[model samples]
Target: MHEWVRRGVGTVAVVLAIVSSAFATPQSLPQTILPGVGSTSWEIRNDGGTDGGPFAGVCDGSPAFGFDDATSASGAGDAYDGAWSVWINGNPFVAPGGLVDVTGTTLLAGPVAMSGLNVWLQYFFSTTHQAARILVILQNPSPVAANVTVQVPINFGSDSNTTVGHTSSGDTTVTTADRWVVTSDGGRATRSIPQSFMDQVLPRWSQQVIRRRCSTVLLETVSVRHSTFRCRARAPARSCFLPASAISPVRAIRLQEQ
Candidate 1:
């Protein structure tokens, strides 16, 4: 049943209406809640595309800028859905072992250049570090070096007046290209992307950029193979916040594709 769905978590909210859908009826829905190893959890909606996922935080933290359960929302960290690329048969491979792999084999009925590029996601909770990890398995099931553009729609929302890339306070200044660190706040949550592993995939990967506006920070990674986005929240830890504005209650950081 393709219909309009309006979902919200905390102060972040959105209204969505889909023209086409993969599930013909409510009973056909695959799964709604995805659980982590421990307290980590995710409430997701089935729509072929990574449309709905209400993630509060890694454990007890709140959603970053806001909730990212919009049409094609790739909310990572604490946004819409974590990290996802392509799918097979207009659906995702939802495995409950804390590990998920989805292939992008959906063929849109249209004239497209690179059609049916295989892409999937490996979402799981790291028992060692106690964090949430998403590994986007982007591969061309077809032989030969095929150059295609993939969208791994991982969305994230930060607190008010929060910043991305670089944020400075007092004599301390922190600059990074991987994760999201808010300016300053009482319950500010900071997430850092796996920049150390960039060199491993730079030869095949394309571009990576993180954007934030109003109350959300969206990260998009353009690559060829696979990209891993990791997130962990530390309670009572120093989070991000902006100047003048009161400390935001929450902010989530996610790594995704464009």
Candidate 2:
């Protein structure tokens, strides 16, 4: 297995990810109970770019890593179910949405120097009556923030097979392209994909980093729990169901037919 390494620059450190071994499966990330949990696996050091600038690395050691939110699954343990690793600039970005497409010859970031290998990227996404949340986990030891984007496919699936998912918005055309960023402030950084973007895309989406490459640190996982409660009248009690109040008697009240 290729071991990812962090080489420091002026102040920013470039993630030197070693190519992943063929046997490396999606199970490699950390397991947690939260709906979506993950980790970035790379050795840390200090020697590529400065603390405030960009840096690059030799993509021959290990795969850099990122995380995606869960749709059907919940907690860190469920992250491996439908995860896929997408490469941008030779770095591994785990899909937080689901299946992503990168058929183009080049990446939006640039000419990545990958070793023509495959790596596992993990992710998940979901929506309900409440707010939509996208949980992202990435490994970066640099001082500057790395810009990241996730593209989710907004297909109607069987609901409307006749219609293509892509739509046009004014001068800007909307494909399965959705985007977000992950940054470090001398510590760990967590990013949330907005609900608005999720509502606008096809059924499929991929994660992309626009400008920089990241190395593995530790696997980071994210989970979202939403609940709504309604108040109801108390029923006739075998025992008193309500709390004792100064205005009410101490004895349990029995209902009588009028």
Candidate 3:
């Protein structure tokens, strides 16, 4: 399902829709609800503290952005299945034993932690830009290298309904790239990340270390005529082995307008 956020003159509205199956007939449309909140109208579903990662949703208004469910295009069933989760060194980040801590936002989730690895997952929101940010910090105290993989669904519906694209641009100080989704109905989302960390990390590590890990940063976005939504994820510096303890640089995803 998808959640939306709308910012007007002096009001911010959030709406959530849970579509069990995007393909479900109109008669069996997805369930939608307006949750109660204070000035900030966003809520995070913790799934009873099971998955550890929280799924963000609208607590009071309509969906301001659109992100396709991971399984929507692949026909593999619900990718997230209404729950948000993460993996570290190939292990699921959950509660009671996995995620050490977590927090929420008006339109997103934030600060997820896992024990032992000293890795923390944090999120940031930009009301001015209508974006969501994910920061993955890995402080590997162990001698061995740590591998990180983050899998979030990006099902932008069928090709006919949404357009997908990406762009790479930047200078010496910072290298940046963006992936975007645009819905026919005028909704848009974008995700962006800096390439500097990966560039610095690639050369020093052995081929074995480089090949086993995932991208250092990932961002995806979708947009409409005047609005955009972005999701970004960043990791520690690419040169993982050089530092005794490393704090990967920041990666950001943003949702905004054209």
Candidate 4:
């Protein structure tokens, strides 16, 4: 009886290993939740469960943006890892037994609803520029006021260089821009000379610097708790031979009572 039990255990282990290998061998593609409409496109990996977010690739001819969990500025997390979440009432948006429903499209709107927090997130592409506009609304149905912090992630990449920076646009507004420096040799250069103009002037090459801007606007008062926020991110076209990768960073803007 002991020998028979040992043989059965070994057989079960072998079967489990075979099953795991079979499932691991095939890699699935990310779901293109938001298909490319005109010049814009977006995708997400639903199979990743909680870790699923937008894919890191071209979105309307610009670098796609996602979520970053790292708090430090220098420690930028993976751009395509997952979508940003909210901290509500001094707690994470999704509770231990909470539910998250993500549904939307590129043609119209994509909405992510969190039942526990009673928050709705909707995103769409800009018609004028190659950018995404995200709208976050919090409905504080609870008796007490809720404090929420919406964290966004910005990831930009290109064949030449990838860099992101922030600057204040107004008293209550902040702007995040991605800078790309391109040279003739397909590498980043400190200074770019206009090859078209330089070839005629001195037969020398000039590097080109391109900057794209994305803005985040807080529509309602943050102190009040029950309010709305609008974040507009756009990646305008650049005057470079190759398509420049530009993505905006996530900015925390405080809204005033209105």
Candidate 5:
């Protein structure tokens, strides 16, 4: 099913205080929200040489960046579809090293070369509705099948959690390498926020996490019999704005590849 997803990357806890013989009792730090372009306009372009081979693309969908749901060239059309190597800035995310494709292995996998990547973060500032969620997508270009896992620390009140598993197995096709997977582990965290808390802070509350950085990563994991391989890419950090942007309410985000 085509699902509309809302997602953001953030840190789990706040370091409110320090303790020393000369210092006072440590105070609890407050939670933070990371900002992202919910559904604002964004795009990316893949580099050369890496063109003919398979690729992947991820994005927060559009009334802005519309997907060709019926077009075969679109990464959104199928698991392995389209060429993706673009940037939200409209410039190529130039490959740091050369593009290396990983093939044939039970013991080896890529550190595949990828560039022109983009990150989208979304947050819901209101307390009245259930519009809070996070989504992540990974684009793989290697001919060899790739496995991936994403990890994040989620903190709600006194609880802390980590991503220990995956939501689904990756999608790989011979013709293309567009993959979308979710966290099967710690994906949801909600606390019973009181009206008193909301009333006190809603008017003055800023959804932005001021002091700490909040971010998430999309990772790749490979199994090599007795040994397993894992690779991860971190998304850029941003502030989570309040009252949410009305311009584009991120319904979905996709990672595109060719």
Candidate 6:
């Protein structure tokens, strides 16, 4: 588990996301949660930009990552999910939002480039899990080998806030999981590699970075936890499976209700 101690968290509203077809130009962003009805819920965006936004959010009834608040800096929501931004050769991949489109259960976003590496995020989701499956499609259209690092800012619970002191935003947690990230409130979320996807490593977490404002640091820790991959010149779009369950149709990842 992360060994640093900083306490903060705030209220996050729940709203249904907008699902749309492909768009030629960028649109606006709608940050909310359609975490399903009753026991199922979700947090995906179809705002025009930041489309297919958050990689993790309220799955089932528990929120493992991300906060749905348009009042935040992003003006739509704050996604603390891992892979928030990708770093190639220490440079971040940035593009104006509005390039997200979800078809059925699969999500496609980006095509951003940094250091001659082009990156696309293909995410799969289920109604019962926080983050289902993530396929980071990497290709060097400019033909360059790049050291790719998935920059992830983790939160045990996005909804875990308190008023005990002058601290209230990005609240700290009080438990551990061998395979998942759990909060004292019984909320859970975790990341792992799929057995079917070979040559892929597990994800790495920060043992010493602050909770919300992760300015700089490598995503991988010393332990066997974090994930990073390499891209050769003109390589095919590689598939990296960020699994939630043990291959149950890539179903039930992210946050599942107890």
Clash totals for all candidate models: 30, 59, 39, 6, 34, 28
Better candidate number, 3 or 6, judged by TM-score: 6
- Model 4, residue 54: C-alpha shift (Å): 14
Tens digits of per-residue lDDT for model 6 on 1-258?
111112111111111121122444443333333433222223443221122222232223221122222111112222222223333433434433544555655555666654444455444544433324544434433322233344432322223331111111222332221112212222121221111111123334222221221111111111111133221111111112222332233211121111
Model 5 Cα displacement at 136 (Å)? 0.6
Task: Give the alpha carbon lDDT tens digit for every residue of 158-254 in model 3.
Answer: 3223322322232222111211112221233232221111222221211112111121222222111111123322111000011101222332322
Could you tell me the TM-score of candidate 3?
0.35
Ranking by lDDT: 6, 1, 3, 4, 2, 5
lDDT of 3: 0.24
lDDT of 5: 0.19
- TM per model? 0.35, 0.22, 0.35, 0.33, 0.20, 0.41
Error of 1 at 136 (Å): 2.7
Error of 4 at 194 (Å): 20
TM-score, structure 1 vs. true: 0.35
Top-lDDT candidate index: 6
Cα RMSDs of all predictions? 16.1, 22.6, 17.0, 22.1, 22.3, 16.8
Per-residue alpha-carbon lDDT of candidate 5 for residues 1-258, written as tens digits (9 for 90 to 100): 121122222222211111001112221211122123132211111222122111222332211111111111111112111112222222223322322111111011112232311232111222222112222222333443332222221111111222223211332111111122222113331111110001101211112221212222221110000001122111111111112221223322222322
Candidate 5, residue 180: CA error in Å?
Answer: 22
lDDT of 4: 0.24
Greater-lDDT candidate between 4 and 6: 6
Worst 10 residues of 2 by lDDT: 232-241
Put down candidate 4 lDDT per residue, 21-59, tens digits, no spaces.
Answer: 212122233333322334333343322222222223222
Q: Give the per-residue Cα lDDT of candidate 5 at 120.
A: 26
- Indicate which candidate wins on TM-score: 6
TM-score of candidate 6 to 2 decimals: 0.41
